[model samples]
Target chain A: MSNAAIPVTEYSTPQRGWYKRNEIAITPWLFLAPGVFFFLVYVIFPIFQSFNLSLYRWDGLGQAEFIGMANYQELVSDRAFEVSLWNNLKWLILYLLAIPAGLFIALFLNQTVTGIRLYKSLFFFPFVISQIVVGLVFTWFYDPTFGLLNVMLGWVGLGPINVLGDPSIVTYGIIAAGLWPQTAYCMILYLTGLNAVDPEQIEAARLDGARGWRMLWYVIVPQLKPATFIAFVVTIIGALRSFDLISIMTNGGPFGTSRVLSFYMFEKALSEYGFRMGYGAAIAVVLFLIMLIFIAYFLWSMFQEERGR
Target chain B: MFPTPIEKTSRTWQITYQTFLPLALLLWLMPLLAVALFSIKPEADFVSGGYWSLPTYFAGLENYGRVFFQSDMPRYLLNSVLITIPTVIGCVILSSMTGFALGIYRFRSNIWIFFMFVAGNFVPFQILMVPVRDLTLDLGLYNTKTGLVLFHIAFQTGFCTLFMRNFIRALPFALIEAARVEGIAEWRIFWYVVLPLMKPAMAALAVLIFTFIWNDYFWAVVLTQGAESQPVTAGITSFNAQYRAAYHLMSAGSIVAALPPVAMFFLMQKHFIAGLTLGAVK
Candidate 1:
C-alpha cells in the first residue's frame, strides 16, 4: 500500500509541474492552432498562390506554363479591361455619395419622437435583405415598359428610357441601386456615432452662437470621425466588391460596359467566355494591388492605435 | 441634438417634419413595396401592364404555393439551412477560442496575428476564388454543401475573431485573474468563467454571421451549382431565368428567399447593430 501510494503521488506531482511550467506559453497555441491553420490554408496562402498564378498561362484544365508577365502585357491592351477599370472608377466616385446622404438622413431622424425606433429600423430595411433581391427589385423598377421609374417619368412626360440596355448609363443605374442599401449602412454607423457625441460640446458650441451648417461642420462632424472612417472603409470595399448586383441586373450587358474588376475576373475565370485561369489571376492581382493600398493605410492606422494603447 | 430636436422647434417645422417622415420612408422603400405588391398580384395584371395599378385580385396563396411546391425552392432552402447552421456554429466556436487567446494573452505575435485577421477579412473575394475552388475540388468537396460551409466558416472567422477579441478585451481582467488564483485549470477557467460571460458577444456574432451566410450570393454561385447543393440565393436567380416573364412567381420566390434574414434582423435588432458597429463609436 505504501509503495503504490508513493508512485501515484510522484506521478501526479510531475504532471502538475509540467503543466504549471508551460501553461502560459502552451495554452494559447492550443486555442489558436485550429483557427490559424484554416486561415493560412484558405486565406493567406491563396493570396500568394494567386499572385504566382498570375505569371503563368493555363486554361484551368491543362498544365500551367510560366509565361513571365505575358498576361499582364496583354492586359495593357485589353479593351474589356479598360472598360471595366473605367466603370470601377465611376462606381468608386459615385458610391461616395452615400456617406453624405446617409449623414443627412441620420440627422433628420436623430430626434426624440414616438415610434422613432421603428422608423429607424424601417429605414434600415433595404440593407437587411439580400443583394439579389435588391437587384431584382431595381431591375423591375427600371423596366422600360411597366417599371415604376418609367411610370413616374410618364407623369413628368419624360422617359421610357432603357436604363440597363444603355451602355453609357448602365453603370450609373447599377450604382444607384447599390447606394440604396449602402446609404442605410452609413446612416446606422453615423447614428451610433451620433449617440456617443458629447452633449456638453454641443451646448458649449451653442453658447458660442454656432448654429446650422457651421455648427455641424465644425463641432458635430469632428466628433463623428470614427464613424466617417468606418463608413469610408466599408464603402470603398463595397465599391470594389460590386459583383452580385452587376451579375444579377446586367451581367455586363450592352457590350460589356458595366463590368467591374470583380465581375470581369469571374467571367474570364469561369463563364461562357472559356476559362483563362492565368489571365483571370492577373486581373485579380491588379485588383488586389489596388485594394492593398487602402488596406495598408488601414493597417497602419490600426497599428498606430495598437501601439498607442 | 446637433440638428436641434423637432419638438423644440416651431410648430410649423414640427408639423412639416412629421409629414415628411412617412413620405420619405415610402419613397425609400418603394422598390421593396412594389415587389411585395407584385408577389400578391395575379398573372393577368402583368400581362395587362397594370403593374402600378391595384391588383385585380390577390393570388398570394397560389404564387407562394407554386414557389414552395412546384419549384426547386424547398431544396435550395434546405441546402441554405444545411450550409448556414454549420457555418455559424463552426465560426462561433473557432472565433471564441481564438478571441479568448488573443484577448487574454500578451504574446509577442498577438497584435500581428490580430492584424492578419482584420486585413484578411477585407481582401476581395476574387483573390481567393480560384484557389478555394481548386482546393475544394481536390478534396472531393466540389459542389457540396459541406464545401461551401467550410469555406464560409474560415472566411467569416476573420471578422468574427476581430469582433470577439475586442469584446473580450473590454471584459474585466480581474475575474480571470481571480479564477487563476483559485487554482482552476486554464481550460476550465475558460469554460467555467469566461465562456458564460461571452453570451452577449456570441449572440451578436451569431445574428451577424447568419445574415451574412444567408444572404451570400457570390460565393454560393462560385462554389455550388444546380438544385442539389446551391443555396436559395443562387437557386432563385436560376428560378428567375427559367420563368422569364412569370413576375408573380419570381417575386414570390425572392420574398421566400429573403424572409429568413429579415426575420432574423427584426428578432435580433440590437445584437445585429451592436455587432456591425463594433468600432464606430469609440
Candidate 2:
C-alpha cells in the first residue's frame, strides 16, 4: 500500500542500479536466512555445545563444573564403555556381512522370472519398516521357550536358548536383526546398480570365457563401485548409529552387552540409571570423531566430483 | 548377463539355482516369517509345546485387538501420525525455499551452506540428544508432541534441504530466467513457476522423510516422556513391559506399528528408491 502510494520515480530514480545489484546480491541470503538460522541453532550449534559439554561434569540440571579432559580420562577407564565400544566394533565388522548377503539375494532375484518384481519388493520389505519393529519381531523370534528360533531348533532336539538373555550371544543376535533390513537396503542399491549395468560389457566379458567369479570380479565389481561405495557408507552409518534395535531388543543388556556407543550415550544422559550429561556428551564426541573419518571421506569424494564437473 | 546367464548353463545348475532360490529366501526371511505366523497364531500355540507349529486357529483380529485395547497402541499410532505428518510438511516447505535459493543463486555461500546441510544431515543424533533435550526443556516444550515435531523438522531440514537443493540444481535454469523476464516476483517464481515443476522431488522427499521420521525412535524417546505424548516406538517399550508374556499381542503390535512405512514403501517404492539413491550412484 505504501509502495503504491509513493511514486516509482520517487523510489527508483537516483540509486536504483546500486540498489538493484545489492538487492540481487542479498536475495540468496534472504532465501537462505531461515534455513541457515534454524540449522545453526538446532544442528550446527548443538554439535559444538555437545563438544564443549564433553569437557565438563554436569548432570543436566545442575551448574556445569569444568573438568577438562577428565570425562575423556574416565572414558578410557570405563569398562562398560569399553564393552560398548567393543560391541560397536563388533557391529561395524559384522554389519558389513550384509553387503555380500544383499548382493547374493539381488543376484538371485535379478532374473526375469515371473513374479520376480513382487519377490524383489517382498525381499526389500525389512528395509521399509522401522528398526523398533524389527527389534520386536526379532525379540519374539529369539524368545527362548516359545520364540521361533528355539521352536525351530527343538525340531532337531536343540534346547531353547535365551538369546537376548545371554550376554555372549546378545549382540550377535541383535546385529542379525539389524542385518535383515540393512541387507535388504544393500540389495535394493545393488538391484538398481544391476539395472544400470552395461549389457555390452557383460556380453564382451562373457564371450572371453570369463565365467563365475571371474566375470563378477573382472567386470561386474568394477562397474558396481559407486553403488558399493554408497552402500558401504550407509551401512557404516547404520551400524554405528544402531541404537534403536539395541535399545528396543535388550536396553543394552542382559548386562549392557549389546550397548553400542549411541545407546550408551543416551543411557548415560537420559535414562534413570543416571543423567551424566557431560559423560554422555563425551561418548557422543567419541562417536562423532569416529564418524567424522567416514564423513570426511564422503565429503572429499563429493568435492572431487564437484570439481571434476 | 555378467555370469553368462543361467539359461546357457547346465540343466543341473539351472535346477539347482531354481531350488536354491526358494531355500535361500526361506532362510533369509525366517525371522520375519516367524513373526508373520506368530502375528496370526493364537496364544495357545505359543503356550503349548511348539512356537514353530502351524497355528491351530487364526486369531489375527484377536491379537490385533489385544494390542489396541490392552495397551496404548492407538494413542501411539496417533502420535506417530501427528509427528510424522508435520515434520514431512515442514521439512519439505523449508527445504524447497532453501533449495531454490541455493540451487538457483550463484552466491559464494551457496555451496558452503549446501555442504553445511549435507554434513549436518549425517551426524549421529546422539550428539544432538542432550542439548536438544535441554533446549526443549528450556522452551517449555518438553514431553510434548509439538516439541518433537519442531526438532524433527529442524534436524531433518538439513537432509531435506540437501536433497532438494541437489534436485533443484539439476533443473533447467531457463525457467527462472523466463520467470524473471515475465516480471514475476521471487516468491511467486518459487510458488507458481518453480514448485509445480518440483512435484516429483517433493513426493520423493515426502516418502523419504515420512519413513525417516516415522522410524525415529531416538528423538521420540528423548523428547516425549509419558504415554500421552509418546510415539509408538517408545509406547512399544512400555507396552512390551506390561504385556510381558503376551507375545501374540506384541507381534500384532509390531505389525500394526510397521504397517504404515511398509505400505508407504510398497505404494511409493519408486519414489522412495529414487530419493534414497539420489546422489548415491551417479
Candidate 3:
C-alpha cells in the first residue's frame, strides 16, 4: 500500500530500464540466496561428504587414508550392525500399528460429545513432550521391581518382567514406548482427514446398508488415503530415526540388543568407543540408503501432485 | 458418523461408552500420570517400596528447589532458551524469504528446488552427524550453543520453507500482480505487499520450531557436552546419570525440562496443529 503512492514514471529512465530488464532474473535469486546457501552448506553438502567419508579410514582427527570398500566389508561382518539392522526392521514393521490404532481412536473421538476437544488435546500430549522424557517415564514404568508393569502383572499372578534388561524383548519394549507418541501423531492426522471426508458418500453408503466395518472400509478408508500416506511415511521415518529413546533408556544396552543404526552410528563415532569416523559414516550411509528408498517414493508422489497442480 | 452416534444407540451402550472413556484415558495416560505423581513424592516414599501407593508426603517444592539451586539445570535451561530463540528467529526469517520467492514467482527450477528442500527435511540426522560435528570442530564451535543453533537453523529451514512456500502460494496472487503493475520494485513488493500477509504463517512456524529445537536431544549430545552448553534435555539425562537411583529428583528435572515445550504447545495449540497438519490436509 505504501509503494502504491510512488508514481510509475518518476524513476530515472536508465534506472527504470535496468530494473525492468534484470529485476525478474535477479530478485528471486536474491531472495533465495541466504536460504539456499545455508541449506547447501549444512544439509546438501554433508550428505555427499558423509558418503565419501564412508569410503575412507579416518578417526575424525587423524589423516584420512583412502581405503575403498574396507569399511563396507567390515560392516558386512559386524554383529552389532546386524543386530541394529534387524532391530530397525522390527521397528519399521511394528511401528505401523500406529496407523490402525490411530484410526480407531480418531473414529471413536470424531463426534460432538461435550469436552471431546479437551480429550483430543490430552491425547496429543505425548507427542508434544520430549522423547527423552517419554524414555525416562517408560524406563521407570518398566522397572523390574516395584514398577507399574510388574505391579499390574502381579494382579494376574504373573512374575515380574525385566522389560529393558532382557535382550530379546528390549527392542520391542523401546518400540512400544515410541508407539505411544507416534500413535497420537497419526490420530491427529486421521482426525483432520475424517473432518474432510465427504458426507454425501457416507450417506449413500448408509442408505446401501453399509454399516460397521463395512462402512468404514468401503466408504471412509478411501477418502483417507492422503492421511494414510503421510502417516506411513512419517512412521517409517520415525522408526528408522529412532535414537533418542534408545540412548536415554538403555544406551543400546544388554549387549547392544536395541541399537538401531542411528544410535549405533553415534555410539561408534563419538561415544566411549574410539572414534572411527569412516566406519560410523558407513553406518550412516546405510541408514541414509534405507531412508532414501522411502524418500524417493515420497518425492515422486509429491512431484506428481506438483505436476497435477 | 461411521460408528453410529452413541446417542442413537441403546442406553446401555451409551452408558458403557461414557464409563469406558475415562478408563481408556487412564490407561493411555498411565505412564505420564505416574511420572507427574512421582515428581511430587518425597524420596522416603520410594525407599518404602510403595511405588504405586499415594505419596507419604509431598516434596514438590524441595525437589524442584534442589534441581534449580543445587544442580546445573538453571544453566541448561538458559542454554535452551538462548539456542531455541535464535534458531527460531533465524529459520523463520530465512524461510520466509525463500518461501516468498518460490511461492510467488514463476520459475524454471521451482519444483526441483522445492523437492530438494522437502527431501532434505526427511533425511536422518545420522547422515549429517559426522560432517556437521567435524565442521563445527574445525570452526572452533564444538561445545558451543552457537554451533548448535546454527545447525538447527539451517536444517529446520528446509521444513519451514516447504511450509512457508505452500502458505504463500495459497495467498491471493492478485496482490503481487497489482504491486508489480504499479512499478514497485520486486523486493519492495515482497516487503510491502506479501510479508504483511505472512503474519499467521510466521506465528505458526515460530511455535512449531520453538518446540522442535527445545525438544531436540540428538544434536545437543552431538554438538555440545556437559553443563557448559548442553540444553535441558541432555542435561536431564546426565543429571539422571549423576543422581543414579534418585527417581524423585530425576522426575523433577524431567518435568522442568519438558515444561517449556508443553506450555508452548498449550498456549499456541491452534497454530501448532495447523503447522503440523498442513500437508496432511487436502
Q: Distance (Å) between predicted and true CA of B264, model 3?
A: 0.7
lDDT by residue (tens digit), candidate 2, B1-282: 544467777999888977877787788778777777878999898788656678899899989888878678999999999989998998998899899888777766667788889889889999988888889999999999999998988898988898888888788777777766555556777789789989999999999999998888989888888989988888888888888777778778888888898899889988998988776456
Candidate number with the higher lDDT (1 or 2): 1
Every candidate's DockQ is: 0.57, 0.54, 0.60
Candidate 1: lDDT of A74? 97
Model 2 pairs whose backbones collide: none
lDDT of 2: 0.85
> On residues A1-309, what C-alpha lDDT tens digit does candidate 2 reach at each position?
111111223344565565453544566688888888888888899999999999999998879999999999999999999998999899999999989988888787878756678778888888888898888888878877667788779889988899999998999999999999999999998888888889999888767888778888888888888789888988998989898898888988987888889998988988998999999999999999989998889888888877776
The global Cα lDDT (0 to 1) of model 1 is 0.91
* lDDT, candidates in the order shown: 0.91, 0.85, 0.90
Count of backbone clashes for each model? 0, 0, 0
What is the RMSD of candidate 2? 4.4
Ranking 2 against 3 by lDDT, winner? 3
Q: Specify the CAPRI tier of model 2.
A: medium
